[model samples]
Target: MNIRQYLDSTYLKRAIQAGITEKENIKIVQGFVREAIDEQFKLVMVRPEMVAMAKKMITDAKSQVDIGTVIDFPEGRSTVEIKLDEAFKAIQDGADDLDFVCNYEAFRNGQVDLVKEEILKCTLLGLKHHKVVKWIIEVAALNNQQIIQLSALIKNVVMTNFKEENYATVFVKSSTGFYKTENNLPNGATVPAIIMMLENASPLPIKAAGGVRTYEEAVEMIQLGVKRIGTSGAKAIADGAVSNSDY
Candidate 1:
């Protein structure tokens, strides 16, 4: 396949969720969004505190952009109420989508009910605002069984939403860039696993994230059935800094 054509065909979504721990990072994120617009790419801005600023940037962009925010980010350790509140506030702030980090510990501890409840909360909130909600499962932290279980859980959630006539999309995502192994390897999600999850997913879309930093890798992901991408290196990848062989 023609690399550029493949990249363009698949939705190239950029993420700007640099946490609110620093001021300079915020400026850099804003600059990234502006530059992404100049390059004509779809963007998903993900800082909880920077949602407002990100929305403003998207609104002011010369080209169209898809604005999104992250809830229960990197940790996914927040209370359900807190996550719901964050989801509502983000939608109210004009975010087009909500990328929610699933409660990894809950899933790890066999708290499937709690995990489902948290995802349901976000689904309801997104429905109220007519926005899309992508659930980040932090796949790198999960074993194959956990990944399969999460897929089943998400399938059930999608069915429930369908019964309620709620039209929110459930997205299985990889990493938040928090955990890493002793090998200095980043603990983010992978494309192959995401595709496997999607093969078992009922109706939700698969969004490949984390270490996707090159045009070729992006194309390979799309061929694997990923509909959206979440990466901070979108500009670099699109500009051909990273190679597909890196994957």
Candidate 2:
């Protein structure tokens, strides 16, 4: 399989998180953009503030790699207005795709309507701006039933509110790659979780982010119908090298 095109080639860690200076962190993101250009992967996923820089860098390099950003990242507890504002900024900053951390806690708290509304508004924002919209359900934070329910919610909202031709423009992604767990377990995408998402979120594409460290794991997800794979070690994966990216 030509796996490069399916890779998002991600680097979402911040300077403070890595104990580096902010300037150094951005340089790393810049390097990621350069790598994405050289590898011809799908895109480079970064924090919102870096979208414009990545855009300019890709433009100057004469590369076709798109730029994507996260919204309500790691945690989905942000209010809808705040999320939308962040998304608008990212859109203006030249983000080609937007991955939103859905209000998972709200849904789990029996606030299903609020969760559905958040999905509807965010999806509409991305579609109207001509960008792909992906929702990170953070599967590790929920039980199996919650995963199934949330996936169904995304698929239902999209089908009911969006045009049939645009269904593929949105995705039900697996994780944010940054969720903290109590048991020190795997906190990102897993095989069973991806399978659950694929089975539940049908027509909507799946972007399996987090913990997809190797080419074989990524290829397995793709063969199972995952439309996108988000990882920081894309170069190694494409070259058949192994590296356990901390995502």
Candidate 3:
């Protein structure tokens, strides 16, 4: 089997959720990223505050690492203006990609148009700076109807802003690691319902995040049409799990 192809086939957004609390941890995470770069991995997503630090760490690295920052984060409670400002700040801090969480509460309250408008605003904000935008439509929080509506809204956004080349991704995520309890969402992006959304999305990329911890899970997500895999366990996946390796 072609291991390099598997590692290089999809976009892997290495998450730095735990390293944001201190400068030392940030340095350690940067060292980890250097190793990923040595392996030819190309993307890294960090918290809003760590963009500058991450940029400094990889500025002279050999790999083409694109920095990403999250807006409205896991809760999705911010106003459109606040989210836009966050995106702008991340860009100024040297982020190459913006991952904005959708307003789940607003969508659940039946505010479909309002949700689309907020996403449109974010898309515009990212495009103005020539940055890639990935809309994290948290599928775990949405019902079937909301998913269908969101899918259409994303398609519309991409079609209307042809020059911008705005990209949208459906993320099947668990609780943002804040809670201590176990999560129900499966590892990787291969959940049946998520696959259904990908099949319906057509053309747009699917980014599988939240619980991906092993190579088997990663491979499963790729087979299910996921174009990107978001994880903090990239090294473990690349090394291969003892029980799950097919090689």
lDDT of 1 by residue, 1-247 (tens): 3332222111222333333445666666677667656666665555666767777887766457667777877678999999988888887787777888899888999898899888787777776677877787877788888888887788788777555344325566665655555676656557657766777774677777677777777778887877777666666677778733221
The deviation in Å at residue 184 for candidate 1 is 2.9
Structure candidate 1, residue pairs in collision: none
Candidate 3 wrongly placed segments (more than 4 Å): 1-21, 163-190, 242-247
What's the ranking of the predictions by TM-score, best on top?
2, 1, 3
lDDT of 3 by residue, 1-247 (tens): 2232233212222245433446566665566557656665546667787778777777866457667667777677789999988888999999887778878678788787788788778877777788877776666566667766676667576666654234443232322322222375432233765666676565666666656667777788777777666665565576785322111
* RMSD from true fold, candidate 3: 4.9
Tens digit of per-residue lDDT, candidate 2, span 131-199: 999999999989999999999999999999999999999999999888888878988899999999999
Model 2: what TM-score?
0.98
lDDT of 1: 0.68
Give each model's clash number. 0, 0, 0
The segments of candidate 2 whose C-alpha lies over 4 angstroms from its true place after superposition are none
Using lDDT, rank the candidates from best to worst. 2, 1, 3
The residue-level lDDT of candidate 2 at 22 comes to 98
Judging by lDDT, tell me the better candidate of 1 and 3: 1
Error in Å for residue 208 of model 2: 0.5
Which of the numbered candidates is closest to the native, going by highest TM-score?
2
Report the candidate with higher lDDT, 1 versus 2.
2
